[model samples]
Target: MRNIMYAAVGLMMTTATAMAAGTPYHEGSATIIEPTDERNPLAEVVSGIDFRKSMIREMQEDEFSNPGMIVVDYGAEIWEQVDGTAGKSLSDVWESCAGMDAATAAVSYPRYHDGAGKVISLEQQINYCRETAMGAEPYKWEKADMLGMTAFIRYQGNGEAINVSIDGPAAATYERGKELYYQRVGQLDMSCAHCHEDNYGNYIRADMLSQGHINGFPTYRVKWNGVGSTHRRFRGCNGNIRATKLAYGHEDYVALELYLAWRGNGLTVETPAVRQ
Candidate 1:
């Protein structure tokens, strides 16, 4: 069964590579579904991927299947715990989504809103609910409270696929995000696709680059050993392209994420809040 799965994965990689050549994605190597850096859509992964040791594959094993579940548990703990002037938990402020499905949410996001008056990231919307409906002070963007809440809430729909919409009023943000993805900026004169789509699966020193997919983030990265915000990863990529770094919760990032969510339509979301 293990070899079968590996073989299946190998087939998927080959198919993805072959499909990548004919598809409309040729910026850098775009990653499809593998964890290695070399699995890019742009170029074939050559030399030294350690495919014999796939962390993502290992995570699928029963021996280590609880990472996603773990983060969700911690998120639940923090949600019910009291904090702020009202000293109320998240349940106190808004509709108690204490045990609701969160995993299905990633795809529904990067949506448009006429009333809110701007594009919103899923993270910001959650904080908005906690602060306004619950009357609690908003948690810091990088706070344990935020990360925990994100992990817990989003873990609800783990196996479900992504479903972002760009046609509604929210389409404007998506449009902006798409432009940002292709726009050349920074001193290095690079775009997001310069490396990700065009270079897809190649090596960068110890790393085997994969396609740049946003669907699986708030991902539990092995190197970081924790859940990290998509924006942090975006910033790192931006810096790598020699672009000026944006603030942690900048609007540009919100726009970019909206675009990314759109690009990664139909993919599954594995939020970082999940236990690893």
Candidate 2:
């Protein structure tokens, strides 16, 4: 009887979620206009302030209490572990090749890499450094160790601003990303701008929408109960809109990442950012 009851409850919950997703956003609910103040443009649109009221926010504030720190700790171990034909640790290679510590390295990511002849994200750079320095095989994109190492590195630059360059070789990619941001698709005929730019600070059902910045990527979402990449979140957003999801590390997504990083130029990096 208990097993039957549990199955029925799960079915009901799934049905409720499906029903909620199918409900359209009311026109009146999204009418809240964004503030025009240039000095504090994001002040009103960002959702962190409201999120801080929750118990999950408290966990994020306290390093000892946050579960995501476990992954960060594991990543530190990976950093020190020797690997590849060169038999150098990630830390050794990063110091020798990049001439910067992991903490500061993340701040300069999603930038053009002359050797690769394209823009690269922090995750890609880490893998590249691994391969070039040690001749080690790169970790898959969604691997826990990869996520952990990314979180560990990004945590070092917690308060630094996102400073992705949109100049020279990166310029064309940035333009393409901008076009994708405004291009409407899917059966719903919506673009990123329709929800994030047009209706930021407005209510979508019970949740308030924000400008959807990527500064807090590799974030620890309460919904996922795990750390996820910006690409993962991007794919989630696409799925929510009924759009065909792109593969992780797709060039288009990389371009989009560069654009979003530039869009959030001044925002502080909030790796392992706690979110619902």
Candidate 3:
């Protein structure tokens, strides 16, 4: 969700600026490179803009509390199911472990994990907590059980503003991700900016692709019949680009997500459970 923001802004600026300067793209892919001379000024747009406040406003008629509920419901069952060597439930260790009570905590994750030595997404964070902290095995990212647990957890933090940091190592990772967002890659030879930044709000096949904000995720994703994680959607975009996607728990993705969240620092979170 965050990374898409950078791509959208950069794509728009990349084209609009090029036309104004009368700079021509020496290109195969859709991206226009930075011009050497001011008069010949086609340049790659910097991928740091966040556009969530306005984006969320569009969904004011909708809400962000439902996804958490659905997930929380499923998560409770998962938590209660016996597992591990002793076949013990969460009650054997922690009384609640926020199963339903702390759904809001999901909104605050994808944070820096000093032990992991990098920023990790909420999905990854939950798995780690479940494994080491809970003395249970971790759930897979795409599992219905895990996804439900995550949705329920994140649901706990409805209505809070997004806050992300790029200080220290996170800063470098964000910059690199920014560069990756703008650089053309793969057989399509297109970077994220090519479609998202350069062609936002334009018709893509049939859909009028908006600026591609991340505020709506963990979107209800009606297509999925329930809520979804932001990273799952991110990987879908990469697959669409024909680019070899980074892994689910890739550090690059966490870095990119961090940068994106920072870009959208003031945006409100909206979840799937609540329909607009």
Candidate 4:
């Protein structure tokens, strides 16, 4: 019932955006990049950009035109700004952590941490670093500081292939996420698979259903009018299904993020992607 209403509203809004922008409601697949890795369940893992209008794709390609860059810029400023009792910034912590480059580290998120002894998403990692290494207060979930920093970090991984491991210590968490993906809840009684897995590429009113990949997360949506974290997007989907919204940085959502990252193992990172 509510799901149907949300679908209708989304359809109308998508149509309106297309009409106002003078672009057609649907775009071609010229921008779609096929996955090089073979672990993907689908024959070809496509980025959200592939499903978006050309105008939106162009916005994502050009840093200046992409609205999400504003958040990235803010994050860049915060990266070097001295803070906390330790007087260290994110840059300092990264420099000390095994000398790994930020771009290489970005795609390996939602990873299992021995210290935390559980799966932690990138946002959780940021907070962990701040609280422990920088002796600074952690940013609240979905807040400007968190979102901006997340986008900035993920942006560094642009064009890098996503390759999160679900084996070993993270296997159990991955299985839980798989269960949640297939589990039906809310009044609509639809699971994530109902739309993303079974009906991708099909039209739900004016909008085309996508494979529900998160590789381009911290994405900017015209509807949102600002950048948002992947968890924030999860909350939106849960709302669209009339489900009880989970708090940001929930363990369950983190597990789901792990599962989705694994599912998109071969897809290229396109952080701060613009979507209609």
Candidate 5:
């Protein structure tokens, strides 16, 4: 069954790559405009607003209308439920270690842990907490439960500034991530900076490009009809570029997440952000 699923994913990725290769953006004919220039014709008109449109934006603002909140609610339940050999809930373990609520815990994530001996994302830390504190098996990266729990935890940090560290143990990994951002790959010979940095506030067909910041993930993408992690979106973008999509929770993705978080250091946390 697992092999079948892997084959299905591989097939889907190939199809997506084939489709993307035909687009003008992939063909290198799409107009690239500067995002920083207010006088640039595309500056005012092109914005991240294209991602959610208006209706989804309105829906996102209303907590009751947002479907993603269902996952958040479920995550809250998981936070308190006792499981594993340690027989403790996530909430209990976190509170004991950090002396704070989950919301604050969410803010200081993708941090370097002495015991883990590396920098880890909030999602990775959650699984670590589960395994060590609760003596439970770690949830799969693509699992719905993991998404739900992550959303719920991140919700607590909503509106807080992203402050991922690049010092000490995180320094080397952070550099690698920065390199990845600028390293050109795939048949199109594009790096992340090509579209997001050099050509931000530009149009590729009807779609407008932004800096591709990760401040709002795990975002609720309307197109997906569900909340998705940074790594999941990374895979989609990689597929679009006809590049090999890395597995979820891979060290490279985790390192990339760290660098991206630092890139948007001053931005407010917008987990469960609505996107098209």
Candidate 6:
């Protein structure tokens, strides 16, 4: 029965990939989703929330009902508290580095880091500050503090459009990410395009598939019973396909985050989003 199930899945993957032929980005080795200026109607980018059930959407819309708010509130507290050998808090450094507020700094992420000499995700930036400026231990990935912190930052950018850069040095990373999205992985032989790109709005068992946009991170998930980061969600997707999961903040995952963020282009930030 398991073998039959795997076969069926393989067939689905092949069919999905074939059906997506001639489509941009996911179709061939070409990486550009579309020009930065012009929008593609065929690849209409929509927030994942649009595909969510109304109840989930309602939960995301209302802060009182949104369980992720609790995490964001916790993060706000963390932002103010001082820590590390430098005797600084995220707030202390915010004024010096991240520009006026978290909200303004939130939309730009998976950016190229000169020191790191590679693209890094928002979560990594937080940790970089902790290690370099704060002189503190970095928070573990997907944990309460990490989730709360990212939720807080992302929430500040709420309603803003996602605007990550994949130009110059970041271009290689974006290309790698685009490849990862379409590359088949694991025992099921499925890629992100199989479920999100091709089968979005289609049902896989009880849950409906979405376009898999990452405009919302540190989102509250009913299945998780709490807010989680995009990398956490990526790990879950890999696991779902029986693929080998990488550690949190892995370079490939960071690159993939860039691709996903760019794919989301103008979608409004919906941090602490509710998903089932």
* Strongest candidate by lDDT: 4
Ranking by lDDT: 4, 6, 2, 5, 1, 3
- Flag the better candidate by TM-score, 1 or 3: 1
lDDT string for model 3 (130-206, tens) is 66556678788777877776655555565565555566656677676677667887767887666666665344654
Best by TM-score: 4
User: Model 3, poorest ten-residue lDDT window?
Assistant: 45-54
Better of 2 and 4 by TM-score: 4
TM-scores for all predictions: 0.71, 0.80, 0.64, 0.86, 0.79, 0.84
Worst 10 residues of 1 by lDDT: 44-53
Better of 1 and 2 by TM-score: 2
User: Which window of 10 residues has the lowest lDDT sum in candidate 5?
Assistant: 38-47
Better of 1 and 6 by lDDT: 6
Give Cα-based local distance difference scores for all models.
0.60, 0.74, 0.55, 0.82, 0.73, 0.80
Better of 3 and 5 by lDDT: 5
Stretches of candidate 6 off by over 4 Å are 1-42, 98-101
- The regions of model 5 sitting more than 4 angstroms off are 1-52, 96-101
Q: Rank the candidates by TM-score, best first.
A: 4, 6, 2, 5, 1, 3
| Superposed Cα deviation of residue 91, candidate 1 (Å) | 4.0
Per-residue lDDT for 176-258 in model 4, tens only?
99889989988899999999888666667777777889998899999999988888889999998999989999989998999
> Tens digit of lDDT per residue, candidate 2, span 1-276?
999999997886575455433212222222122333343234433423232334656677688877778888888899899999998988888866655677667776787876567888878888888888878999889789799888888888887866667879998998888889888977788998898877654557766566777766688888998889989988998998889999999988998888777766766777767776
**How well does model 1 score by local distance difference test?**
0.60
- 1-276, model 6: which lDDT tens digit per residue? 999999999998776655444323343332223324353222666677776655887898898999989999999999888989999998788645543367866788888877557788878878887888788899888888788888888889998877888889999998999899889999999999998888775567766677888887888899998788888899999998899999898889998899888888777788988898
